[model samples]
Target: MSDDVYTGGCGCGAVRYQAEGRPVAQLHCQCTHCRMRSGTGHASYLVFAGTEAVTLTGAVRVWSLKGDSGTDKHHAFCPVCGIPLYVTFAASPGITAIHPGSMDAPERFAPGFVTYGLRGLDWDRLDAGLTVFDAGPTG
Candidate 1:
């Protein structure tokens, strides 16, 4: 992973993306929006501090949804396959959260913390270690 370059595409190959550099933080978000969007208990995300670190190509569609912060979040995906690739927020335009599954090496995603634990389902378990927050971590 030290090579710091990765590329991946949507299931239908209609959308592709490339990202450079390592992630600022990797975490599992248990927010309802995350669970529903991922079709699972949570979403694994690799957050990069610089939005420009990632670039996308091909036909991609974006859906805007409100985030916990009360700001619009832009979710990018492949319309053909409906595979979510990344997300950016209106509040934090400098950051980008890329779905680890949308990257070439998903195994490289080593989540260091868990957020939105208040939204976590007891039935869906995750061993995300000690750094856990009830909701979004407070400053």
Candidate 2:
């Protein structure tokens, strides 16, 4: 991956942010929470460094939900446009999950894997080469 910063914004441009380091991982999440939040079969996410590496410029509406692991997951979205932007897991408090579609140029990052495959829609075809996991992988 390139050692360049990635910038992105909400659909209505009401919320903008700049992430200053290369992403650790990019993946398509098929968890139930993600599916509901994105209103799609899967949600594309890019894992960034931390909140310190990201600068936010607009008010974001946050919705906290419990993940399968019982951790509180905070989903942030642009109130004006109702576009999901990021998600933060209380378990992994340091990392930030950014929605690839919210980025100004999403093509810069490609999803490397598909997570929570068991909850994925039957009609959705994920990348065959990716490491499919029934749930989040243990580090």
Best by lDDT: 2
* lDDT minimum window of 10 residues, candidate 1: 130-139
Best by TM-score: 2
Over 6-26, each residue of candidate 2 has an lDDT whose tens digit, in order, gives 889988899998887888999
Model 2, residue 101: C-alpha shift (Å): 0.3
The Cα local distance difference test for each model comes to 0.84, 0.84
- lDDT (Cα, tens digit) per residue for candidate 1, span 1-139: 4568767778888888888887888899988898998899999888877757888889788999887656788999898999999998888888888898988778888899898888899887898464878886431
Clash-forming residue pairs, model 1: none
Clashes of each: 0, 0
RMSD of 2: 2.0
Alpha-carbon runs more than 4 Å astray in model 1: 128-130, 137-139
How many clashing residue pairs are found in candidate 1? 0
